[model samples]
Target chain A: MINFEEELKRFFPSLEIEDSEEAIYRQDMTDAADLLLGVIREDYAGYSETPTE
Target chain B: MICFRCGAPLSESDFCNACGVDVRRYKKIVYAANSCYNDGLERACVRDLSGAEHSLKQCLKLNKNHIEARNLLGLVYFETGETAAALTQWVISKNISGTNNLADEYIDRFQSNQSRVETMSTTLKKFNKGLELAQGGSFDLSIIQLRKVLSMNPKYVQAHNLLALLYFERGDFEKARREIDRTLDIDRGNITALRYLNEVNAHLGIPDDKNSKGIRIFDNPSAQVIRSGNETLIQPLNDREPLGLGAFIQIGLGVLIGLAITYFLVVPAKERAAQEAANAELYAYGETIDEKNATISELESRVSALEQNNITLSDSLAQYEGSNGAVDANNYLISAAMAYIDPNQDATQVSEYLELIGDDYVETSSSYEFKELYTYLLNDIGDSVAQNYYDTGLSYFNNGDYTLAISYLSKAYMYNANNDNALYYLAMSYYESGDISTATDKLNTLIESFPTSSLVDKARQRLDEMSY
Candidate 1:
């Protein structure tokens, strides 16, 4: 059951939405994908157009 | 499937045949792992790289030795701009399954380009810099560096996970959730990701649905691993169902609170705003009315002053009209001028006309020209009129017409107040016509007025007789 006090505390007005930059081509770093992520793929063709480095 | 309790294969039984230990939970774990693997394979076929990565990570969590899952998860990471994470998964998979593994081919491809491998190591060093920044409480700087690292080397799992962790700490839960979701997609069974997600879920008020694998529940903390003569025993605990009515009450109260807040707070605030606006309008109108009244009062004062001025001007205008003082003065002066200029006209007539001009009008005349002209006319007319009136009075006195002589002599004296003859004869006429009182008054006037004249002797003699 939902405790009313705990539930009421959730509405304390501190939660504020923040904005962030969106990158279209984003990769998720899965731990399962990388128990410790390995340098494997070579599809850096699209990202190379705008070199961040 | 092999039993977790016994190093022996089992044949479709809930318990291990060799150890007499229940293996129902373990079998379900294996089944769940297989189910995830199947789900991953379908996602991979459809090129849903993120989903496949997620499903495969779940599969690996249940059975870390799932070679196909580890290999596939790496491949999925590669397609989604995370080359380092993909290669890392493949390398681990190949290490686990040493010979002729499918991960070997992927690893060979990476090893073939030695320069690229060096660059990948450099990316790792940058990742370390981002880590130090985060530890130093420079979360914003760390986030920037980590995003840059991900863009350059998108497969950097640590970068994505750290970035998410920073967001989670900064109260940027949406960003944290996005990062955590991305991390889970690449590594579905990542404990750090799952743990962070549970925290995110707790803040979000959702259950940890991902952690609910087909694992045995251990309720009694004491019984799960009890040491009995250097041997440990494990037991499982079952979960109880929830009571439903309490959930309903909280829902009903939440709705009631939302309604009360709108009615008591928001509605009153709106009404107060409306009333304040009305008061402001009323105040503005009052000011406008005050201004208008001030203007009207000023206009009325001006009009009253103008009306007073008009009345004064009208009275002044009436003074110059027919038979008023100004007109009478001008008429008498004109008649006197005409009579004086005419050689045949009588001097007495001019004197009579000049007399018609009142002393009040002449004294009040502000004009220098009017006063000078009137003075000259009066002097010229007075000499001739006094002589003529004096002779006429002597004629009347000799004829015994005393009343007539008195009137003529009085006129003669008025024209020239210094004429002693006119004064003496006028006094004698009054003495002869009146009683002793008149005789006495005449003698007193003759004696005082003409003390040097011949009339003074007779006047004193008459006065002595009257007194006797």
Candidate 2:
């Protein structure tokens, strides 16, 4: 038998039109490519920070 | 594609040509995003909106700057009736690619009709409310709210799944199956709809397809598992052999209950209908009686009015036959005319008939012809009628019958005003009748009116004697 309470918990409230602006503002736009670029930039900064090589 | 380091284009090598930076991983990420976008496009074309949404979101996670994947995700969201979510994706897509972007067109189309936006807003609000109600354990109210939401936006997969879940919870397996079927029609690979369909199918005793996708999303513990030679045979424990005697007895009890229901519900309904029909007929009869009574009263009033009219007409006829009435006066004139026309009839007969036509009738009447005719007849017999009256009055006066004398003398004087003999006798009759005042008046009239006559001196002598 379907546990109605357990099943109902899966459904979340749909976003309303008024909340769309806030949702868009709070969205995480960071992607895998951005993470890769962040790693590469950190590596370049670390190399420049090291003593003369 | 542009390099992240210096905004320079890349080459076939593992590095950006202008920036001299490694771009092999970045190119792999772009290629992976492109591959995901291709998969999503294929899934969307096949109407697998749920699969498409997964692929498109994966593409966006790999490369958020993928405009095509982002636009497709918005379309998938719009198709599923998540307008605000779709608009969020499109708005982000447009911000990333300001010009020559498909998101611009999508946003323009969505925002063109103000009423459509308002309707979608209402649909979303109702769906959220339904979800809230469901979470609060008000399943029935949630079902009603979700039904309204689906009526406004039928492609809303979330609302359909929620409504189907509600039906399943309420044990309405057939209705739950229908809502799930509608949800699957919109989003074929929807996991929620598939799960609900599985539950509904199990409740309805429909055999589940072994190879169907998402069929085993929820495990049914009531099924007995039997393993035989690398194959598992699952049998539902609830499917039982029928109880021969107990089932028959239950069927018999159901038939008896049906008959009882027929007797309790149907029989009274038929009797009430009969009673209502009888009451309606009685009310109609009463209305007809009231209408007939109204007609009778109207006719009675008409008859009463006619009776009053008849009485007024009778009174009018009686007035015409009275002493001074027009009918009586007309008859007297007609009689005088008839007597005057007869050769054997004496002037006395015509004169008496003319006297019957009262002086008031001749003077006050409107008929000129009647007055002219009466005057002509009176003048024709005036001299003889006056002489006869004067002789009768003189005889009556000498016989001491002053009343008789006065009556005849009055007529004689009325017919011929110039008759001195009639005037003298009329005055003498009044003197003998104990009317001294009237006698004096007549004597003075004779003296003033006929000064040259021998009766004038006699009249003056009578007047002087009356004064003494």
Candidate 3:
């Protein structure tokens, strides 16, 4: 048996078309270079604290 | 590979052969960049522009001057309708190589067609206007504008993505899905489109597996909550086990029965339903493709029409740019006023410019000021023109050239319709030329227009003589 109120909440009011202006403004394009750089930085940061082999 | 420390080529050993610099890490980086470039090239060959873009970016990060990767990235961008960005990349590539970059060919292709370049410029303007409209809360107008932009550049992924976002904001998940799918078709791994597709699927209640790519991307804590008769049930997807003793037996029996039922009835029924749904979706998509083709046909015709109109407008604009009748008229009026102020200043230039403005301009005008100016100019110069035409007409009439005589006499009558001699000579030219019907019409016009004229008697005499 499905809950009626929960089902109703699934249909959230759509964001206004004007709100897309801010959405686009806030949009940051990310590609694999950024991902690779981030991952490398994270590994480098954690590598210093690792125990020596 | 080259040594980073001393700029010397290295052998296969860990150290540079010439400079003895430790080049292992540098060599590894270069290898990794090459590998990424190779991956990008492979993906680009298969037209996976989105994935190719990503791999190429990673390659450039590792080695900024990876020429082939950079050029391929520009090509991918061009295919996706980012012409400016593609041009920027190719320019950089050309600058880096300076001699034999394929980017040069791409740049040349873009520059070769003037009309196509102008259309691209118009497309970009329309896209920016659409973006402005979307920001200003005019989604319908924005969508219409974006459709035009797409018609101009079908692979414009940004327009498709923005249109999809608008559809999503309108709660039209199906349209949003359609638009996102089109974007993905151009660039298969476009993250924005993929994200939108996930959202649309969720809104449509298409159940995804717990470990699906979209679900794992977010790492949702609660997969789903099953509420059976007001009792909240939590069944962790990762943890399910057989119950103990009688519960296990009953569960096993239930599972067996469920499997039996599924095998016997549900599977074939579900397959049939799925096939029907797929067929319906295919038909709907076919209709959509037909509509798009029709729109493209209409847009092509409209573009040709607009191009022709542009040529005509350009010619008309050149005429305006060369010399304007209105400006000449204003100048003449000013010169005439100046001449009125100074006795020494002659106003012949005024009549000259007024003639340039022409009688057609004066007669069609509804402006009282222009009419007054025209009347003032005409009162000063009109009698002279009528007299000139009368003199020319009589000369031509004496020369026995009735055609030239009628042409000038008609002009004399047009300028000064009250000229009885000009009208009589024009009618006589017509009669002598054997156009008796036109001569009769002209004589009748003369009598009706100037009933008290002395020429009316001669006109009646000619009419009676012609009748004889």
Candidate 4:
């Protein structure tokens, strides 16, 4: 048997037109490629820091 | 594929040719995102929208620059009545790829029609209100609000699912099942609707058949689902067997009682419902008529304003047309030009026509053709006209008519500035008229314009006397 109150709690309020701007601004756009680039750039920076003997 | 760092086009090699960064992993990430997008597209084609939504989101999470995946995800959101969510995804996608992006078309399609946007906005508001009402333990009011929302936008799956939940809570398993069926009809892969269907079926004691999945019972009361071993059968739920005489008498009595009850109770309630529907329809028609009347009144006022504007413009236009207008001035100038070119017409006739054109036309109106033609004609006969006016002025000056002499001499000097005698006589006439200021001006003009004239010493003596 489904619990009506508990099931209703799963439903969230819809994003109104007024709130769309904030929702878009707060949306996470970071992807796997972005993460990989960040990691590679960090490693490259660290590698360049080593002195050439 | 493109390089993540410099945005350069990728080559077949594992490294970027431009920036020299290793791109083997980046290619793999993009390839994986494309695979997710393909999976989402397949799911979407099969109307498994929830599955499609999940795969598309995974694609976007892997590659936020995947515009196709974003657009498909937006479509999925729109299908599930998440219009604002759909708009956000499309907006982000448009920002990610500005040109030749399908997101631009999708956003334009959704937003170009203002009425559709308003309907969507209102439907969303009512759905939200319904959800709030449900949460506040007002199940009946929520059902009514959700019904209204669904009536406005029948394809709103979320509203249907919420209505189903309300029905299920109110112990209306049949209506709940119907609502769930409608939700699934709009979005086949709506998991909430499927789960609710499962619960409603359980409550109604309907036999669950796992073989034919997603099969929903419609409003057919006689239709039955039966599983015989591995196969399913759909026969009538209440199949009437042959009845004996006693059974017939009992059925006939029951039918009579049913008719009596229906006539006494159900007919009146049905009539009230019909009357309410008619009243509601009449109110809708009244609102429409009022809106049309307002539009008609606005257009009528606009027409009246335009007519008034037309009358004012016509009046203003008429002032620049006709006998006392610019046309008359132009005609006078044209007549003067014609007379100057005529072999028989003298300078006096041309001068008379030119005077008819008036000073206002020459001083105020800067007509290019008028100025050109008038200047040419005046220059052609200026010397002869000056001699005529100078003779007339000398006669007037000797007769002691200084005002008439001044007028004629001024015309003579105006026609030909080289007539130094005309200038000297105009100064003498102004001096005799006792207008010392005018006399001084004419005397100075005579001395400055004609330095070799015999009147220079006389003009200097007069200026000295005026100063003293």
Candidate 5:
């Protein structure tokens, strides 16, 4: 898997990824996995290749 | 803050206490270096090249990795005219920071031939303007502008050359030579300034050689002078010469002929005529002298007789005056009395005679006689009495003795009713003595009688005040 953060570093050389508001919000969403789990299931139940790992 | 390399917690010290990372110490060094670099950058921004160089040196001393300091230090050196040193510094800075492009830009701009060309073009424009002024006959103004251009770019060879030309045009050969010398000092091979220098030298007749040649004395100086003197010099056509001998002889002969003609033709005729005229004049003079002598004798007799008659008349007049002294005294007394009574009247006949004598006495410095006559006229018995009455009246009136002033003033008024001074004073005396109605009546009569008198205004003012 590509490290999006490092790839973005090449595009925006002056960027500070950990200090970015969008990156922080994404981290918060990942941390609330239980709250996102039902929404994810309802939205992609028919998708066969939704990786479980 | 965490250590980036080791994921260690950064300590206050350079070395992480747990992992010995040396992070804080390195950060401190970087901060110091950056501070000095920033200071150097600020000084460079203000165009303080020397101060910027010093700050940048300090930055480099603090941290050898300060690439910005090295690059800016090069800029400072370039600004201060140290081109080689600037190139060295910039190369080192570029080595340290390959991303820095400032040093490259400066090197490219400064090393180009176009820069010198542009400078030359600006200097040429200044020289052209100076030339224009010089051609316009404003030499002083052109010299001033050319001097400013030379100061801005001293190596402007064309400006120095043209400035020399302007000085030469103004007849200032010394200044022209000095300007050419300046150009030569800058560039020894300056052909234009050199050519102008040679031209000035040729015009001035100064030898192009450095050393002076002494005068040669080959031949005998006295012999050469004698030879040159012996040569019959040809006189120019316009040369002035003395009159020829023939012309002088002719002038002398002409003058002699003129003298001979005047002597033979004019002298005898003029002499005979003068002799006849002299004889006639002598006869006429003799008769005139006789007539003049006769007239003189007659005039002498007449004068002597008139003198005798004058003496007799003078004696008779003296005798008559002596005999009529009392009558003259009486006449003077009456005239003086009349004058005192009517001060406006002309002097009587006796006073007129006295005035004539007074004028004669004044002209002859006979003040004593004039005083005697004046005293007799002024202090005669009748005139003195009248004057005494007038003075007593004036004194009484001035003293505010209204009843007595009225009586004395009335008597003086009878003698001369036109005495406005006495009348006005008398009216005031009456007014002061609480007889307002009497004072008003007196002033009314004075005003009506003496309309042109000086005291009329005072009388009217007094009457108006009393009425109010």
Candidate 6:
């Protein structure tokens, strides 16, 4: 699985992506997971993605 | 002496040493005149108008043939509003230099406004006298004088219009109507008179006929009494059908009887049906609200339980100390809790969850968790609350909406006092809006307070660029 830091670097170009130890340790995996869930919930509510019948 | 052709300083001699020009008798006089001219130019550069005038005058006094000194002295007088002096000096300079261009330009500009100045002064005197007479309650006399002014200057629309208003105030409708008609004749679409004409016709109960160009002068006392009183004078619909008091009483009684039958028979049934429908709607609304409240409470309790489980998993991860799998599991649980406290899903609920999480984090000394929870809490409160203004401002700034960004950023700065991000964005917005001084002050404050921020280098660069 892609790391939270890598996912964030892919989405946000304005954020600086450095390979410092602090960057690796402060990855905030929970925030990443929360953002993913929010996107999924929005897609479901807007009917952009539907469950198979 | 050194020659004027070579631009060399002179000595007390009969000829120029550098350029070989014969400057025998006039060399000393020309040199003194040039020095005075240079001194006047310097004073003019510093905006010392009086000193510049004195120096230029001295230059001309030393050498009456110095045309440049005379021209510059004319400019000084013109700048000081002494138009006559300036014209005289320029005419003399033109004679000395044998050039009509500069003197003619000054004379042309001055002569264009001379007639207009005389007319404006006369009009001002008459307007002031009219005002004094009107203030002393001499309304008819004021109107008469204003009419004379209109006759002299037939296009004086304000005089005709004001005289009409004064006559109207004095209750002389014939005179008022005549003056208003004159005003409208001069300017065909006078909105003021048109509006006053409507009021006059409504008061007199007279239908305005388009073919009548002359003012209607009525001597009928009944029309005058109805015009002056506050009584409603409804015109007769037809000449053959005159209205009587007995017919009015019969019509009023018929309306009263019809209203009584509708109130006694038709309204009770409609009122009963409306009451029943309203009660049924209220019952359904109450049930729905109650169901929603219960569901929300249940969801809240489940979220609290999940949070407790996450806390237990975090404790377990701490006990295991270096177990990667346990830490990953703990991270997933916390992420789920974060998603449950989403801001976009009902902000009030999200705010409640964040408040609870903030309290827990504060008690546990979890500063990292506290910061994340606080940030989310601020965002959930939205721009209506000042704490969320910075986040909203950032969203606007990123969208290139500089005006809205400045509005929200100013509110955020008022709330938090030390929000460097809001201050920086506010300055940028102000700079984009062409407010340079406010932008400079904000940038100065940010540089002083947030030197270690990521935007510090950019702010410093902008400050340097703006300093010049």
**lDDT (10s digit) by residue, model 3, range B49-120:** 888999998888777667898899889977887666676777777877878889899889989998887777
Identify the superior model by DockQ, candidate 2 or candidate 3. Answer: 2
Write down the lDDT that model 1 would get: 0.70
The true-versus-predicted C-alpha distance at residue B358 of model 6, in Å, is: 99
Ranking the candidates on lDDT from highest down gives 2, 4, 3, 1, 6, 5
lDDT of 2 by residue, B1-468 (tens): 888677787778887777666789999998999999999999999889999999999999999999999999999999999999999999999999998999999999989999999999999999999898888888889889998999999999999988988888888987888888888788888988887777777886554663433223226766755533223356676777679998999999999999999999999999999999999999999999999999999999999999999999977765565447788788888999999999999899999898887786687652789899999999989888888888898899999999999998888887798987788888998998889989888888888888899998888888888889
Least lDDT summed over 10 consecutive residues: which range in candidate 3 chain B? B209-218
Number of the top DockQ candidate: 2
User: Mind giving the per-residue lDDT tens digits that candidate 5 earns over B69-152?
Assistant: 877887765444334456666655555567746767765775587675455445545655776676566878878878977776
**Candidates, ranked, TM-score:** 4, 2, 3, 1, 5, 6
RMSD of 6: 57.8
Q: Is candidate 1 or candidate 5 better by DockQ?
A: 1
Q: Give stretches of model 1 more than 4 Å off.
A: A1-53, B1-43, B46-75, B79-81, B85-331, B340-348, B360-413, B419-468
Q: Which residue pairs of candidate 1 clash?
A: A30-B186, A30-B187, A31-B187, A32-B187, A38-B84, A38-B88, A39-B84, B82-B154, B82-B155
DockQ, in order, for the candidates?
0.03, 0.40, 0.02, 0.35, 0.01, 0.00
TM-score of each: 0.33, 0.51, 0.40, 0.52, 0.22, 0.20
Recovered share of real interface contacts in candidate 4: 0.78
- Chain B TM-score by candidate, in order shown: 0.35, 0.47, 0.43, 0.48, 0.23, 0.22
Residue-level lDDT for A13 in candidate 1: 15
Candidate 4: where is the Cα deviation over 4 Å? A49-53, B210-468
Name the candidate, 1 or 2, with the larger TM-score value: 2
Please list the residue runs of candidate 6 whose C-alpha ends up more than 4 Å from where it truly belongs after superposition: A1-53, B1-25, B115-468
Q: State interface RMSD in Å for all models.
A: 18.8, 3.0, 12.0, 2.8, 26.5, 40.7
lDDT of 6 by residue, B38-113 (tens): 9988877675555678888777765665677777787775553333356566666555566655666765675589
Worst 10 residues of 6 chain A by lDDT: A11-20
Candidate 1 lDDT over B1-468, as tens digits, reads 765544589878886677655567567777888899999999888756557878898898877778889888878766654556666677677767898799999989978998877666566666667776766668789888888877777655557777877787778876877787776666555566667777876775444554332222234443343323212235533334335887688888999999999999999999999999999999999999999999999999999999999999987875564234687778888898899899989787788787788766677642578788877877778888888888998899999999889878887887788887787777778778866676677667767877888878877777787678
lDDT of 2 at B63: 93
